[model samples]
Target chain A: MMLHNALDRYHDRPSSIHDLDPRVKVVVTLLGIFSVLLLPDGAWGAYFLVWCAVLAVALVARLGVGLVLRRSLVALPFALVAITLVFTLPGRTLFTLQLGAWEISASDAGLVRFSSVLVRSWLSVQMAILLVATTRIPDLLHALRHLHVPALLVTILAFMVRYLAVLLDEVTRLLRARQARSAASAQGKAGGSLLWRARVAGNMTGQLFLRSLERSDRIYNAMVARGFRGQYVTINPHRMRRRDWMALGLAFAALTMIQWLGRTLS
Target chain B: MNIALLTRLWEEVVVPRMHIPDGFLSMPVALIFWVITVALLLLAIRKTQQQLGERQIPLMGVMAAFIFAAQMINFPIAGGTSGHLLGGVLAAVMLGPWAGMLVMACVIIVQGLLFQDGGLLVMGANIFNMGLVTAALGSLYHGLAARQSKGVRLVVAGVLAWLSVVAGALFTALQLGFSGTSPFAIVVPAMLGVHMLIGIGEGLITMAALAFVMQVRPDLVAAEAVRTGGGRGWVIVGLVIALFVAVLSPIASADPDGLERVAIDMGFEEVAMTPPYELFPDYVIPFLGETPLSTILAGVIGALVVALVAFAVGRLLRQRAAAA
Candidate 1:
């Protein structure tokens, strides 16, 4: 929930990071992800160095460690699943234990693979956290459009972000009504069958969809009344400032230094 | 069966956990998913324009908001791995297939952009696998179910939903397999095998939801108008059969996911690349190295975060709409 609060806090901010063009951020983020993944497996030193570099950027962006840590935990399951490769894998076993019919073994190779995945995942998640923390959802979509992401995709995303709140409110209202009716009914009767309850829930979801469909029609009419066409036009075009270039340059420089150090050290 | 089971599934299983971290997949794989997602979006938009009138705009938005919030309520599953209703099928069942695809596409995009749930580059892949496939397949299943008995309809919806989720995972696995990290022989079986179990939970939830919807709001079933013969039945059946093939696709290799397979194959899975500052080992936990506790803490935290963010965003957008 705190993570959600943090997202809300940054959603409307016009910070320096937020000010950068979405296209630039997309490119930088993509490159950063690619470069991080490209680190040869077992490149622990390089991985740590890259992590520090990303951490530095996060600090500069004014994103707190608490926020980053909270967000990073989102990726932990995948990291754990990936780490299982070390133990489940078959090869020369470093350690083996027997439990009934199953023999659990850990492979040295699997350990290296697990660590490599953890490092890469950590680096990538940090970059993503930084991106979301800095940019507004709408701005990011616009940036994607300018960067040559398909117009249709951008439009779909825009509508999604735009209406996400409305549906949530409707759902909350529906739930409240359902709870009230259910409580009142329960007081009068032993309560409905499981099937009856499920059917009611299904009906609620179905009604929600139907209402949404009608609402979509109304929204379209409103758009047309406002002289809207099918094409989506941005209200404000994102312009990359000199500071954006400087930031990009700094990032590249840091990446280069890490790569150089990694090469020399290895 | 009971409210507790439903609540458990909604709270623990069917929510979008956004588990696969960024930088896990290769660039080529990411690019491929991106391309597929974009293409599907364009097609869905055009289809929406052709099928529905302007009313679809606000409708799509609200549906998206609903999905965003709905994702917060995950249902518990076996083996610590939970599942959530992607709602792609449910959306398609109500809004028509094309419209459902667009709604799902939007949800995934926003999640990637605002929540950082999936990477930007990989958004395309996520959409195609999660949205397009689920919507298309769900629509097909519903069509076939309509032709059969009411009992069969629920069963069909549940099975189709389960298949779609597994298929989506398989597609991702195939993408990773093609990148040369792991061969299909290893990845396909593992990913599909686990997700197959996960899909059972998906099917049960979907079936229950569909059954409830049919009982109360039969009119909302998008296919209701067309199902009374007029050759529409055949079309629906055809679509379902087509989707079956799409989901059962043999394209996926048997390789493990990119990061795990690569790490295992390359021989460097253990070298821990510690972050510069040791602020929190198990970030979601009070202390470091407590994985189970941390994971649970993280899941609860994640669910709350998604719900709040979605609620606040919905309220803000409602205000904007009213003001406009």
Candidate 2:
């Protein structure tokens, strides 16, 4: 299946970061990212340290350096938005580039603001990628359930994870069929106009939704027939071990100090 | 438009990406929105669970997955580019508002968790912008779409969908303004202008889908209508917000050049001189202008737009209920 393992990029490992309870890993990753954002803009010291810290985490988790870097590129377009602001910002123009009638100037203040937002998003996503890569989705859902998330929300999330890949495959197949039909039509004539394609897209969406609704109807009926009650129940008896707490506390304290020092020293 | 600027706009401002990334919002502003979103989400969860019962739980998952998958399918816009469905209104049309909100919440949670499509710190803000706000507008639009002539239904659905996207963009500008990261004045007109065009595309897609459902699967929407029998709640919500903004806009705009204050934070509030369309030069970015009258005028215009859209939404919901 082309869609297999497309979303589940989990790297199973027995390393310390990988072995941490998913709850601990989630909490630590959140705290770590929050602290990273809290670091004042232009605090290069804080940003560099956090970057190194996340890299260390990735390393400990047996995640390849290249994978984390590549995954972190998802936020680069957003960073480009910030970078675009650097030229328009009101400040001393550090440099200017003229092309045609346009004068594009990069301001020093704008550069500072842009880079701050850029690094912040970049580093935050890196930590997030590391968290997901090390922890299994099952463990993550179990952790959410253990963390006192409502049963219904947790149940829904469980179903979401289970069927997300399946739905992706279904959609991919649908897309291929659409492409085949479109290409066949194109060979005989020009492809449809924008409106025509939009209607087709809409039809495809309607069809997919109908299929999903029918599928869910069947799934629900089957569950009810199998004597399923109104409650969605899952049993997992995984306690937070001492090592989990220790790891979280130490990481928490270190991140806190890094943020504090970044604010003061900068 | 300069080729460079056009591409930059496409890459940065014109992103089909629904959720805002981290660092665009400051700590306090994000946290405040997060708290509000969390409270709203709790109520939605409670209501959805009550309405859906336990039997409908599996369907929530399927629906969530379906929306997630659909978002990945990008349809071609003009210019060889494409935009995907935000799907909030579509979800509301299929499932009622509260359940729609839950489905949206699930999709966002999955997107953030699995793909990191949005930042974790700003996930709450993302949920608010892309999910909650859209759901509120969708349900309200659904209400307006009720019992009307087919033409009215098409026009209203398309306009409301467009307006919802624009409204989401406006709220995004407000949030960015509140964060002191970007001044409201420049961001408002700029974001609004781009989103207005984006909204038209959104409207077309939504109308097409509505037409499809109207023909083939009225039953799917029937279940949704039964859940959405809450009359005038949407009106009250719209009125309160409009009134609140109209009341507070003056005080908020008391200092005309809030950009100076924002300059201390990051310094990038250049005026967007090449706005594709200027509604009115004076009120383009209302608060930044010289007159409180202009701000209030803009606020009134805003209020009127909300009321009109809300009315359409109310009518739509009533129509759907009657049809079902």
Candidate 3:
């Protein structure tokens, strides 16, 4: 695939983590994530364990520490908003500059809850990125199908996986053309006001939609010519091996233990 | 594409796409949305399959890819921030609500799994927030086509598109509030206040798309009649009702003492509960004299000050770091 973007850019490497069956990776990652989420708010010990476990996976996968940390910043902005909750929520108004009924308190409760949310979120995002960075889109789709995601939905994802790059190229072309024309119009009398710019965007979008519709018809004709069936055909089907199950079990046990210990202690 | 366009695309790597990231929603709230989204997707698949036979399936995929690509071409909305095409209303206008929903759901799921724009668990919530809300809003206005002018339909679609984004933001805020991340009263206003400006982009884009399509291929723009399935509309109706209640519950909880007094006076409850296992038990704040109104005022003011300081400090840090 010539198309490349930072998001979902699959990096191929030979390692045990990379070699694990995609289904096993999916289950294990989900286990790790769920445990992180299920850990009672502020169980730092378990959270540390989960982080260490993720680091272990990263080492095995040979994923760069810098790469993982950089990709993980995608969740930061959303997390920042929740961090503000620590300042706003009420419990013990430890110290305050009161303006009538309004006050600012560094509540013990809010601080704990906010940190818990942020840490859990950050860990889960790491697991998510790790799973994507190691696995191919096709393998992920196959895993989803094997896991019995509705075939129709799976097919749509498959198509999306296949055509996303192509459609993006088309959009880029359209955007280039639109921006060029808009630039010319900007030099003219009508002026490129916000509304006008938006209208041009909408027209470009309409053109894209029409083009897509026409391509769909042509693609349908081509498929029908090639004896296209209504249902999706599963390609390269693979069964879980002994190693896959072992990997899954080890992951499940570690996560379960961490979660249970965390809750019990907290 | 030109060099400039390529660089623009490269720069876009820094911006967050409109997909909701994970952990903004709590488990219970996320699970509730997932259940609702799954049910709707199942219904959507059946309806589309029935409406277009097997033909709908391929079209749905194409539509998904189209929307995904189109969303990438964002222009400015405000404050040097830009917004992109949501395409829910556009999809609903182009395809019927069911098929439009199918496309939106596919797009959202792909974004989650492929890009991690939203997490796996909360992917359903993201879809429900954006797709189902769009579908419902589109369906709500589907009846306007009876004797309405193309101009009028275009205008209505434009307004609905704007409103759909607002509705999506509402559900997201509600989910966040339920998660205890923020109070509903605070989150709703904050989410809506930002989205109100963003909604203009949606409105303009939707209106432009509608008018352009109508102009170019007037024959192809078919408006599906909205009157057929009254009972089947329950999903959207239920979602709306749920959203309003979720948005309001925080305010209700804020005045617990007054509400309890009313309950006692009306004899609606046994004055003494066996255990009192309700959500916000003893929510009253005491440092400000333990008054209901005072607590609310505290929350409002605290939220305001936090937001103001956060915005100012964020700008300062960004500028200082950049300058350095």
Best by TM-score: 2
In candidate 2, what are the lDDT values of residues A177-254, reduced to their tens digit? 776776544447445777887787777777778888888888889888988776555566677899999998899888
Name the regions of candidate 1 deviating beyond 4 angstroms: A1-5, A11-15, A88-93, A172-200, A221-225, A256-264, B1-19, B49-53, B73-84, B142-155, B172-194, B197-201, B204-324
For all predicted structures, in order, the TM-scores are 0.72, 0.84, 0.80
What CAPRI class is candidate 1? acceptable
**lDDT (10s digit) by residue, model 2, range B52-158:** 67767888888898888776555677666574577777776677778878898888888787777778888888888778777776775555555456677677666
Candidate order (lDDT): 2, 3, 1
TM-score of chain B of 2: 0.72
Off by over 4 Å in 2: A1-9, A88-91, A99-104, A184-189, B1-15, B183-185, B238-324
Candidate 3: docking tier: acceptable
* TM-score for chain B of each model, two decimals: 0.65, 0.72, 0.68
What clash count does candidate 1 reach?
49
| Residue B176 lDDT, candidate 1, scale 0-100 | 45
Candidate 2 versus the native: TM-score?
0.84
Task: Give me the runs in candidate 3 sitting further than 4 Å from their true place.
Answer: A1-11, A91-103, A181-191, B1-18, B223-324
Model number with the top DockQ: 2
DockQ of each: 0.25, 0.38, 0.31
Computed on alpha carbons, the lDDT of every model, listed in order, comes to 0.60, 0.69, 0.68
